[model samples]
Each structure stands twice: as structure tokens, then as C-alpha cells.
Target: MSRLEPLTMPVPQSASPATPAARFHNVEIILPRQESQAAAQMICEVFRAANDLFPGAPYRTHVRDLATQMRSAPDGWKPRTAIFLGGISTRWTLNSGEKASLQRICRQTPRCLFAGSAIFLLPETGLNTRYETAVHANFAAAAKEEDLPCAPAGTLTTVSDRISTAISSFAALRLLTTYLREDRGAFIADAVCDYLGLALGPTADHSRVSLQLRQAAGGDALIVKILELMQRNIEEPLLIRDIASQAGVSPRKLERRFQEKTRTSPLAAYRKLRIEKARQLLLHTSLPLTEIVAATGFGSRSNLTEWFKREYKTSPQAFRKQYYAEREPQRSLA
Candidate 1:
């Protein structure tokens, strides 16, 4: 990975030392009508975690619809930062009114972030014309056709002036962490990254279990694909046969490969992944046990409780309570 340049907010030269900064910074996340709610929820969760860690709730986040915003102009309220998420289809082009509204928003906002196919909007809004934007491989040809200044292939993210662009979900998370580090201190940013299982820099640490699983696979494409499938289907796990079929292998061969490489059965590995996910949600989120059970593919409260206790040697509620109790001092210091 290339070295990431520091992300800094441009300070006004006229500001004196005695000038007080705003207590809270407002962030606006704009989504297209057809876009998934997942991206918007992810952005909001980042800020929500930050607010819990910070004393003053430094970041205030809001979500808005792009179509609605274009139809009705913002009532003289501009956010400190505006983030645009990619839509389901990049085939649609912006009309005159939408383009004008976006241009005005980008001009007024102090910082703007474009993720995935949203980079195409830069040309239409006349923003980031001078910057080399990180374009996703899927959208690179379309971006170039639209006259976007695409960065070199495999470039994850780019920050130029007040604008930042990220090509993929991982890149977007990194970019968001950089922005958080810039706004808050490194401590707060690192804390959020750790909670989200995100790495701050190229050499930063990631989820240990995940990293170990990948390393154990030893670059076997089949095992890697199976692992990815398991991770993606955490909320609704696939049967071992279905998983093997999707990976283009027979169930017996899949089990043999797993035993040879990781020394664990496919069913056991899948159960472990789901339990790990449940543990993370228990620690980081305030969702109820029923919700966590549902989210982790556990069939019922009793079933999840049984498996969770077997793995962790403690009940889920007890674990969550103890974890937060242990972190109380750290929260106080923050």
C-alpha cells in the first residue's frame, strides 16, 4: 500500500488564537433514491460511536435523500461536511436542477466525500477537477467517458483540497477514519476503528481472528472464497453443501480441504464466525439479544445463549455488562 497523505482541514488565516471553534460539527449524508440504506447506516454508526466516546458529542450526523434535496432546496442550512454515497445504478445521469443543487452544496460545504460510483458526480458538479480521484475498477471506464480525472488503477483513495474520493468499501472506511483522525485526535479515531474492525493505516492491525483465518487459508482461492461467503452470510448462513456448490466443489472435497488447511470442519468454522460476529455486536452495539441472535444466524434466544455460553464460558448479557463495566474508566478518560 502507498503512503497516505495527511488529511487536514484548511484553517482560515484571519482566525485568531482566541477564536472558539464550534462545539459540534454537522455532517450530511446524501443518498440516491435507489441506493441501499446500508451505506448510510454505516456512516451514521461511525458518528454515533464517536459521540459515545467524545465528551461533547462532537459530530452530529443527518441523512437526506438526493431526489428530495434537488426538488426542494436546503433552507439556508449547510453542513460542515457532505458525503455522497453511490447509487445502485450509475447508468442514470443527473438533470439540470440536481446538478445545480449538488454544485451549490459542494461549494458551500467545507469538506466533501465521494464513494464508489459517486465519483462520477465530481465532473457534473465541477468539483475535484484538479484532483486525481480513486475510481472503482467497475466504474473506471464510465468515469473516464464522463471526463473524470481518474487516478491510477488500484489506487484506493485520494484526498485533494476539500474533496476526498474512495473507490471501494474498504477504501471508504479508511477515508472515513482519516477524516475522523483529522477532526478528533488519534486516540478517538483509533478507538472507533478498533470497534469497527478497521485499520487506520497501511501497517495498522486488523481483526486478529479474521487475519488469522485468511493466513491459515494460505492463499488457497477455494478456501478464501468459502471464507468470504461465510462472512457475507453471517446473518443467514448457508448449508455446507450449498457453500461447497457455490465454491464449485463437492461437499466432501470442501471438508477435506478445510481439514487439511485449517484443521477444522466447515460447520464448526461457520459457527465460530457467527459467534465472533455476535460477540462484536454485543460489545460494540446496544442491540437487544433477540436482534443480535437474529443478526448472527442463531435460530432462537435459547440457541444463541447456549452456543455463546459454550464458546465464551459466560452468558451473553453477563458478557456485555462486564465488557462495558471494564471500559468505563476508558470512557471517563475520553
Candidate 2:
């Protein structure tokens, strides 16, 4: 079993300089009654990642609950885009004031997005009477009963006029990335997706070779399956021979296919995946160095640091510090 050698790979660079935009777009994430806090936080995390990668802080996000109807948005708080997260119960009732507030916000905002069960709000608020909505299968019957215009079966998301709807929270993430790609560029959107360990999806038209090898694996079914196995077994990496056996190919064939498709050996590709996972945990999480090493299958802090420095040109601690140091001022302002 050979180990991955120290290879210096250039970090993904932004296409433009870090200059502030003329004006930041305000985005309001509305939780129409009780919703998943984790879902709302994930949405905000995407925006934050975009802000970190892009030149300027192009978006300012606010999480508001319609359960506490304030009658109107606060002074000087004009949201350009509003997103309604899904998790509310179909039977959960809303009063006139809440419904009115939802309607008012939807009418005022230039763009609106509904995720998961939040599609129900479309008809309830009189916003999507004429447009087809991407309703989750779990809520399809309910949506039909409520007279909501449901899109065709298996539709993940749909956009009509100024409104967009998604069938599930995962689809909502992809929709948000699509919006980001339009607002920013493919570089920024793909970079953020790479950092979050998310697929850039079929809509991405970027030409950069992604650090996540799965993105560049092309149409090789064997390579794709092996890459997925590598991703799933990050905490306890599998040996090349074992992986080959599980993938139903000989070790020699696995190595040949990986090299042909990814231009890297099986062991090297596996190491890269683990290193990338370490990078994500370092930036997006508060886990300590030892925990990160253990989780990424590096076996020791020194090993993790050596490969992390080789891949990212910085030690894990320094990388984490530099990233958050740059983000602290933005947090204070927010």
C-alpha cells in the first residue's frame, strides 16, 4: 500500500479581485410558522460561503419567522429576495394576519423561493395561482387537495415568473446554487459547492477541474462508484485491494481505470478525497485537529498537517485561523 506523495496543488482562485459591490442584495429567509432551524442555518451557510469566496459581500441574509407577524418589514430592511423554507405541517393553521404578512412579503419582494412543504404557502398566499409548483411526493396529495398547481411527477424544482419552488430541502440547496451561479459566476458557485462537499449539478457550465475528483470522473461508472465509496468511507479508509474487490474489479484494473479517468492512482485519489474532507471540517466546523485527523483517516496530526500543507499550502490551524480572521469583521457588521 503506497501513500500519496506531497504534491503542491494551487488553490482555486477567484476570477476577480476582492472589490466591494455597489450595493448588497438583502435576502430574507422566512420560516412560515415552525420550521427546521438546521435547514435555515444551512441556507445561511451557503450565502456565507458565497460571500467568503466572492469579491464583495453581495448578499445580506435575515431569518424571520412569520409566526410572529410584525405587520411589516423593519424600516431600512428591504429584501430583494425572499425564501420560504419547508418543514411546516400541512395541518398547521395560520391566522389571517400571518397569511397577510406572507402575502405582503411575497408581493413586495422581487423574487421568492419555496422549499419542501412550503409550496403550500403559494396558493394560501394567492401568489402562485397560475404557476406550476414542484411539490414533494409526501405533500403531493395535500397540495392537489388544496388546489395548488403541482408540477409533473418527479419534478425536483420549477421556476415561473418571479417565484420558484422545490420538492425537497436538498433540491432547494441546488436551486440556491443556481441562483448564485446567475448572480455571481461559475467559479464562485462551484468553489462554494466544493467547500461544502456538494455536487455542482448538471447546470454548472464551468471548465475548471474540481478539487473533488468525483466531479471530473466523467462517464466511467466504475470510477464514479469507487469515488462514492471513497467518500462514504472517509473515517476508515479501505485498502486498494479491498476496494477493488468490493467494486468487483481487480486491483490492477481499478488502478488502470482511475488513472485513465482522473489522471491519478487509486490510492492517490482516495488520499485526496480524505484531505478534501479534512479541509471542509476545518473551515466549516469547530472540530479540533486530532478529531479532524481521525475523521479523515490521516491517523495522526503530523500526517494530516503534512498533506494539508502540501495540498493547500498552509497548515490546518493556520488555514482555519486565516479563514475566520477574514470573516470576523463581516460577522460583527452582520
Candidate 3:
């Protein structure tokens, strides 16, 4: 499995020039609740700092940003993202101007997104503000399909309001310093790619993207069988036609509907699946190169190396090295 890399630290509220890609995808600041006066003040401070940094950039041009119930927004906060999911049991209110809170909601069912899926839910955004997170990463090189508009991740309602104090504020400061010194772009790109590949699938392309099916029990059953077959005989040099026959679909139709939906051809997608698995084993296990090749369904080590390089721009050995060296440092801390 690929790992998620967080930004080393939050950026200082100072002015600095960075690419759009580098500017975004480097930080994931999860503000679970911002309803209190303290929350409002904290949000204001963040905005003031951002305004001081980039005086001209607009904020909150998108509607999703203004979805907050608050009447006023922070000085420089840009509400520039829209999120689309299968469905969200929205928190609604009544006509009496009293807040309406609902009970008995299904919580925490992890949503599964395939590779190359893309959705744009903000076709109608009325607010006008720019949005940016103060973090370091190369958001540009991280492919576009992976950079869909992000939605609020956690449940809107929480039961408790107990714990106080900023969580790990001191530790955050130290990490931020180190991150700025490092090649934050590469790490950020990795994080961004992981997010994209996760939502779309391992080989999703931007030109082709689709919405994820929310509750596809039957589709999921088919996915399991297909994935099992791919995993069991990855090195068989099988064609899409062969796989489709096994999957109960005609080659041409699969090419049309499935490939269009996924933005990647069946063979390419399967190769990605195999390579990703190969990548995992190569990094996690002490298995030899030949064994890894056999395990991932490559005909030979050379074959694996060639394909891995073509897709990832690095040899298997090099990929293993980078992944481990980059990953382990982050992992041991967690």
C-alpha cells in the first residue's frame, strides 16, 4: 500500500513565490470544528497572515467555500473547492431560524474510488475568494486527475467538546522547519499522487474521469473476482480479450464502456495493478528480484524492470530504495 505524506510544517504567514502545484497538495490541515469564538479568532488570524502574504490573489471564488453557516468569513480565506461524493446526509435546519440537527446517521463507511475517476461538483459557485494552504509540496507535477476538489472529510456533527489546547502545536513547528529545508516538492507530489491514485484507481488519467459508484454490491462482487484472477496469474501475458472472456464481457464493449469510464485501457490498468503490487512486495519484503518478478507476474526481472521504469521512471531497485528511504523515516514516527 502507498503511504500518505503530510507537509513538514505549516508555512510562515510570510510572502513567498511558489508554483500552483507546489503551493497546494503539500498540507492537509484538518480543522474538525470551527464553531466557537476561539475558532473564529483562529480562523481570522490565519486569514490575516495569508492576506499579508499575497495581497492581490482573490479568495473564495467557489461556492463550496461559502457553504459554512457563518455570516462572515476570514479576511483572506478563499472558498475555492467543491466536493462530490455518492451522497452526504447533510445537516439541515428548520424555518424558525433554529438549528436543526439530525440523529441516526450512518457514519464512517469508507468510500472506495477507482483509478482515473474525476468529478467536478462545483459547476455553480457564487462566492469569490482564493484558497490556498500554507504547506510545502510540488502540487504541479502531481497529476491533475489526482487533484480533484476536496470535500470536508469527517462527519459534520460530533458528540463531544471536551479536549482543549492546540494538538501538537510545538511538534508542528519543528516539522514545518525541517520540511521547508527538504525537497518538499517531491514529497508533496508523492502525497498528491497517492490521493489521486486512490480516488481514481492506480492508473486513472485526467482526460478520462468518472464518478464513483456509492453502493455497488454487485459491481464489488465482480471486482473481487477480477482482481483475484489478476493477482493469481499476473505474469501470464494475458490479453484483455482473454481477461474479458474470463470476466464475461466482449473485448470491444469492454474497450468502449469500461475504458472510457476509467480513462485507462484494461491492459494498462492491469499492468498498473501488477506493478503496484510488485512495488509493495519489493519495498516491504526481503524477497529477491527474481522472486519479486515472479510474484508480480512479470515474465522476467528484465521485463519487470522495463515496465516499472516506463511507468514510474525508475527501476525496480531504485524505486524500492527511494520508497523505503522516504517511507521508513515517516513510518517509524507514526
Candidate 4:
């Protein structure tokens, strides 16, 4: 069995608590490949921070083929990632829990002979928020058939081949990150190659260069770092000072930079980001309102509803209904 421990500490409100030298803490999860209930238990434990897995017996054998993997990233406060990998025959169903513990989507892979999977969870709110959108669109574009299964509430969605390949490609990331920090352009390129099997072309080349230059420019780098930190730990109720500390700056300095760049305080920006995340869950997932609140870092359900009303001029439930109603015709045509 694997152990899941929280590395995050409660962040205080005082700005002095943030120091210039503070770095984001890294939490490690290592799970060895197994076939029995222990494997299921281990997998659940590994993702307990965000989700719960209810593997049917027929699906148990599929776990036999999965290799143990490790992920060491800063804690994501609400949206925990859940992964479902099936072997040649897929029979697993995963339910994103009833509570708001998990926010981000999970990965489920197809029934590949070796490995297949796809991710299910919420979208990214900060940093490279469009990252999930780009990857999802690309994968969908290449998918000839939807092998992925979507079960009723409390069941697992089957993984698609494209999604599975994308997920499996990252199985070697423990090796890749050893030499390249995540901030480097090469790191992103390697990941794209591993996941998409596409070589870096001129467009990618230019994008990488632009990103590098931007990171090397000025306050943008600090902003990027802070965004990364927020993206990682958005589930936690972190104070501005605590976030600033992770970016290696003072609270006041980080706030000043945010105001200059976005015309909003850092806290306001982060809260807005959180609201957007909740909106994603509301629109894309059937998660309960309570879970959405928990996953989005809203202190309570009422707070989430209030925030939604403020941002969209409607309640979350009504918003979800309207979105689905508008999309029903498109879904039917498709």
C-alpha cells in the first residue's frame, strides 16, 4: 500500500510570514505495480488527496500490466489527479468522489496491449490554464473512435486510445525531470514528443523561444513562478504572503507587481482564478455543489454560490442548467 501525506501547512495572514528564500515544498508518491486488491488500495491511497477508485473485479486484472510510477509536484489544493489504466481488456469504472476533495480531472487510457489511459478532473485555473484545453483538443482531433466509456454517477469512464497514449508517454517523466527543470523549453518539448509523438517544428520552436525570452525578461518571470505556485496549491487556503514566499519575493512586492501587470491585487486575481475553476467543474462535470466549493478553495458551499452569482449574475446550478441546455442540441447532432 502507498501512503499519501499532505506537505502543506496552514498559511497565516501576516505578510511577514513570507520570506524571499521560500521554495515550494515537493511531495512524493511512489506506487509499485501490483495485481491484487493491494494494487487497488495503493492506487486509491496515491490519489486519495483528490479522488477515490471503485475498481470492479473484472477490471482488476488490467492493473497487472501497469508499472509502478511516481509523481512529485507541489500539492494541488482541490483538484487531485486520478489515473485509470486498463490492459488489453478494459472493465474499470472510477467515480469522482461525492465530496469536493478532487477538482482536476483523472487520466484514463485505452485497452492497449501494454498501457492505455486518460485523465479526468477539472481544468487548470492559473499558470498555463489553457494547457488542458490544448491537450484535450489535440487528443480529440486524433481520436477516430471514442473507446472511452462514461459510466453513470459512481462509475469509471473508459480511456480512449489517443488519451491513453498521451498519458502513457509521460510514464518516463521521472527520468526526464532528473536532467531538466520543468521551466526549461526542452522539458516542454520532450513532454510533447513523448505524449503526442510529434517532433518540435518551427511553430513549436518559435513558441519555446518566445517563452524562454519572456521568462528571461523581467517581472514576468516572477509572475510566472507565482502563477505556477498558485496552480499547484490552489486547493490550499494560502495567504498572499505564503504564495509570495514560494515565488521568492515579499508579499508587498508580489502584490505591487500584480497590480501593475493585471490591475488587481494578487489575492483578488487568485480568487477570480478559483471562481473560474469552479465554473469549469460546474459546466463540465456532474460533481456536487459541495465538492465544487471544496475543490475550488471556497470556504463553504454558500461562498461558492455567492461568488458564482457575483461573477456570472446567476447561481451555479442555474448556470450549469443553461450551459447543458444550450449544448444539448450540439451533443445530439454530434
Candidate 5:
């Protein structure tokens, strides 16, 4: 009878393959974001940390922010300092290892930081919202949940971007304020809302089910349609509002559904979609950074450079130099 008690315990192998699982992990690290002068050492420390845990782990991208305006950040850039996840295991795939190291920095997860801190969940776009740039260290880890519509990046960086001075949103404005930062949760919540608005653009939710049952209980179709549209037009530089319109819903409705389903908004999704495309472009092309910026709808070289600096923490030129270009020298030496 005592032995029988153990039999009821579900073996690890018995777990359903489809169940969203939590990756139980704890991480603590300080990313010095504005310390680009020490970026090389930081890079080494990050790799060492990763190797310490998962040996022979296939590494991805080393995203860096190369902003020179460390003392006074650009209009939307300051205080937004933070790090790319320095050491974390990406969901392992067959080919990821083969492409590991500096040569393919374009397609890997960027190891990013800025202004002596790491920014979490910063959009790769040129604009920075009233989100708290950073005051403390950021923490993030992967927790798998029921499948949600994802960008072609096929990934999400669920993280906490530290708030130095928080602000609230009245409707539309990316500027910062002190009121929001006082209440951390509310600030984060507001940031999420703003990003969602960006994602939803002007779409509406046509969720007939929720309306039929609980007046606001329907969202599956809206979510599904939005995902499909995003996937189909992965290459286009469309706005979140555009995605909402395609779903036959208003931006507000679509944003609501996105919030309900994925706990994030459509604008974040759109930004990520474009960032993922840029990632692919970085991996596959020898195109100049300016050309890449234009191709990815990043507006101008300076803007794209700023975004790249904030999102990945390195200038595109440095990234290409370390990963893609320098390899030839190594080969020649060998």
C-alpha cells in the first residue's frame, strides 16, 4: 500500500506534450547599460555566465546599445537604459547551434544593455513611450503558456523595464511623467496599455461570443484573425491599426482581445514583428545598415541606429564587425 502511493504520481514522461510549462529558473545580474566602453568585458562576462550554467550551450545574438549620448539620452532614449538577457537558454532547435558565435549575430537574441542598465521589453522602434526607462535591475525568464499568436521571431521577451520616472497615458503621447513612476505596478500597467494601443492602432473587436454571453466575453476570433494577418504579412511594414482593420474590428477592440489573450497589446506585437524581420535580414544579408534600416521601415539610419542601440545595445556596424565580418580574419589565421 505504501509503494502504491508513488504509482499515482504522474511520471515526467507522462506529462502532456501540449501543456504550457513553466521554466523554473532564477537569475540575478546587473547589466551596466551606458558603459559601452566596458562593453567588450561585459560581453565576455555574459558568455562566461551562460557557459557556467549550460555547457556547450549554443548561444544566439549579442545585442548591444551603442548610444554615445550616455549622459543625456536622446529625447526618448535616456533613462531607458537596460540589458539584453545576458545568459538565458533559448528554446533549443536543431540548427541554432550550427549558427552560433559572432558570425551570425544578426539572427540571435541580442545581448543588450544601455546607460549602465539593461532595458527590458523596449520596442525596437525609434520611439520610446512613457515607460520607465530604469531605476533597478531588470528580471525576466521564460514561462511557456497555452499557444498565443507570436511574431515571426517565434519568440517573446517577457520582461520588466525599470521605471526611473513613471507617467500615465491620457490617450496618445509618448512623453514621460513622474506620477506614474511612484506606483510601480500602475506604471508598468500603463506602459503595457500604451504599447497595446500601439499594437491595436485603430482596430475593433468583433468578438461576437463575448458579447453574446458576458457582454465582453468574446475574443478568440479576433485573436485568431489578427494572428493570421500578422503571419501573412510578416514582411510588410504595416501599422497595428492596419492589422486591426484586417480583422474587421476597431483598434480598441483588437487591443482588448490582445490584452486578454496574450496579456500584451498589438503595437508591441507589431514592433516585435518588424524587429524579428530585421533579425532575419541581419542574419542573411551583407546589406549596409542604412539600407537595412530603410528596408525594415525604420525611417532613417540614425533612427534605426538608435533603435538598434536601445534594443540590442550595439551599433549595427559593430555587430556586423564582430559576428559576420571578423570571421574571415579568423579563417585566414587558421
Candidate 6:
């Protein structure tokens, strides 16, 4: 669902909210692995999700041999590259031919080109995957079906270090491949989740707060925890009194602390975070305005539009258009 070519790919299956197995389906694609250029081209085509990010700089790989080993191996790094999937109908494993083909396309290349488009059904991890090392571009996922959150989908810049984390993101596509001779979908899912956990680190980002703000809170861990909770549940209509009770303080005391540290009331801060989340959804996703309204707890599309106009002086549609128009030149030049 991330991105696909003219070729056929698998589609996601529906499952009841209580059913985990029904949430998955198999997806596969077999590219032309004979010629290096053809193989790289095929890979780029399949990873169109990433290729499209930097339009002028499409993905490329130029490697001549697979027998060459890496210059040096790092400690505690067991380098093995394999694809994982879920809801497969047949057993699969990496046969000699496919493994050799992959080595020729990836391992042999000095800088192998890789892209993947797939979807993964995940449990309630609060965390998802992403490929960017910094925080400029949008973090995109596939469609939102029912209430399931899509896995992070993108391209990897390198084949070492945390390459597994980046590649696991591409598995968000609805397609499944059977290049393996044994059933490894479950194993792949586990590995992907573990790698993603490592990549995302051990803590959730509390809205990218600054050290100055932390100091302003006067080392108030309660205030920091409350702010993080607000960031985590941006869509929920959480009341200040509830937050105050959770912090073991009166609503008035909580408001005083918020004003002292953040120069805003608790509800005001929560609303700001919700609107910010709405802005992100508008920029990164293709969901309808109604869906965005629901996701952000804006009560209605008109309410969302009102707040968006108040903040950005433009409708969501116009904001999206203007944002892209501004970025179009950069993408073209890239």
C-alpha cells in the first residue's frame, strides 16, 4: 500500500478487532535478477515509495561482484539480510538460486540499491517505524483500514548498522514473496518489531521539548509526565481536572504550574498539540478531511477548518497545496 508498480501485488485482509491472525496477508514480487542494472531498476521500481521522495535523485546501485567482503566487521553485529512477512499461505525459505541472486544484486554492489513497499499488522506498540535520521520530511504510512495503524514504510540509505530497521519499514506493503523455502513470516515479524524498537529508542518523544522548558518546570517530573501524556493522547478530550487529579493537584494549581512553565493553560496546551497533530496528518497522509477531523478529535470538519484558518490563515486543502508548491522547487532541484 505504500507504493506499487504496474505489476500485481497482494492486498490486505480484514480481521475483527479481536482477531490478530486475520489482520495479515501474503505479498510477493520476483524481479529480473540476471543483469545488475535490470535488478537495480526492478528494485527501484518496487521501492517507488522511497524513490519518489527525492525525485531528481532516484535510487541507484552499481556493484560488480558478490565475493568481496566488507572492509571490517563491527563487534556484536551479525550481518544477515532477509525479508519477513505475515499471513503467508505457503512455506518459504531462501533457496540457493534466490540467495545467490540477492547476493549478486545487494551484497556484491558497493552500495546496493534497496526499496520495499509492504504493510505489516502490528499490535499496540505505541511506536511505529520510520527511515529518516532527522525530522524534516514527512513520515508516511499506508492506508488506515478500520482502526489499524500502518507500519512505517520507506527506503534505507545503507545496508549496515541498523539496515534491518530501515528495510523492515518497507514490509508495510500488501504484497508477499515466497523466496524462502521455509515458513519465516513469524520470525520476520518478530525481528522487524525488535529492530524497530531499537531504532525508535526506549522513550517516546514528548513533542520535542527543549532543555529550557524542562528547566522552567523546575524539575517537576509531574508536569513533564502530564505534558507527555497530552502529547500521546492528542485526540482524546482529556479535561484539565482529570490531568490535575492525575497529578495530585487541584485544577487551579495545575493551571498555575502550566502558566509558570509553558505560559498557557492545560486545555490550551492540549488543543495546540492536537492542532499540530492535525497539521502533520494533513501534510503526510491522503485521508479525507472527515477522517482527519475524527482522528484529531476536532468534533467536526468545520471546527477543524476554523482552527486551521485561525492558526495558518488557510484551509487544510490550501495549506496542503501551498506546502507542496513551496517544496516542489526543492524536489525538482534535488
Q: Could you list the CA RMSD of all candidates, in the order they appear?
A: 15.8, 11.9, 18.7, 21.9, 23.7, 18.1
Name the candidate, 3 or 6, with the larger lDDT value.
Answer: 6
Q: Please, what are the lDDT tens digits per residue for candidate 1 over residues 1-334?
A: 1221212222223334454445458787776655555667777777776665443435666666555544454466667888887743464356676777788888889999988777777877765466788988888778788777888998989999899988855577787888888887565677667756565344333333444455466647787788878888999999999999999999999999988988888898889888988999999899999999999999999999999999999999999999989989999998
lDDT of 6 by residue, 184-294 (tens): 333232222222232234633533232223335664776777776677666766788888787788989888888887676778677767777788888999888899898
Q: Residue 272: error of model 2 in Å?
A: 19
TM-score quality measure for candidate 2 = 0.55
RMSD score of candidate 4 (Å):
21.9
> In lDDT terms, which candidate is top?
1
Q: List the candidate 6 regions with Cα displacement exceeding 4 Å.
A: 1-201, 208-219, 330-334
Cα lDDT tens digits for candidate 2, 1-334? 1221211112224423343323666787876554545557788878876665453545767777675634645665556888888763453346787788887887778889988878867776765467799988788788889888889999999998788988876788888888888787665677678667676454432212233354456546898678767777889999999999999999999999888888899898788778878988998899999999999999999999999999899999999999999999999998
Q: After superposition, how far is residue 77 of candidate 3 from its true place, in Å?
A: 4.9
Candidate 4 on 159-224: residue-level lDDT in tens?
232222223323322322321232224534343333333333432222221232223333277766
What are the per-model numbers of colliding residue pairs?
0, 0, 24, 26, 42, 19
lDDT of 4: 0.42
- Model 3 earns a TM-score of 0.38
Residue-level lDDT tens digits of model 3 in 34-139:
1122322322232233232222231211111112322232343332221111111121112221111000000111111110111111111111212221111222
Instruction: Kindly list the per-residue Cα lDDT of model 5 for residues 116-178, writing each as its tens digit.
Output: 112322332223343333222112222113122122231222222332211111111121112
lDDT score at residue 316, model 2, on the 0-100 scale: 97
Angstrom error at residue 70, model 3: 19
Give the TM-scores of the predictions, in the order they appear: 0.53, 0.55, 0.38, 0.37, 0.33, 0.39
Residue 104: error of model 3 in Å? Answer: 31
**Cand. 6 TM to true fold:** 0.39
Q: Report the lDDT of model 1 for residue 263.
A: 81
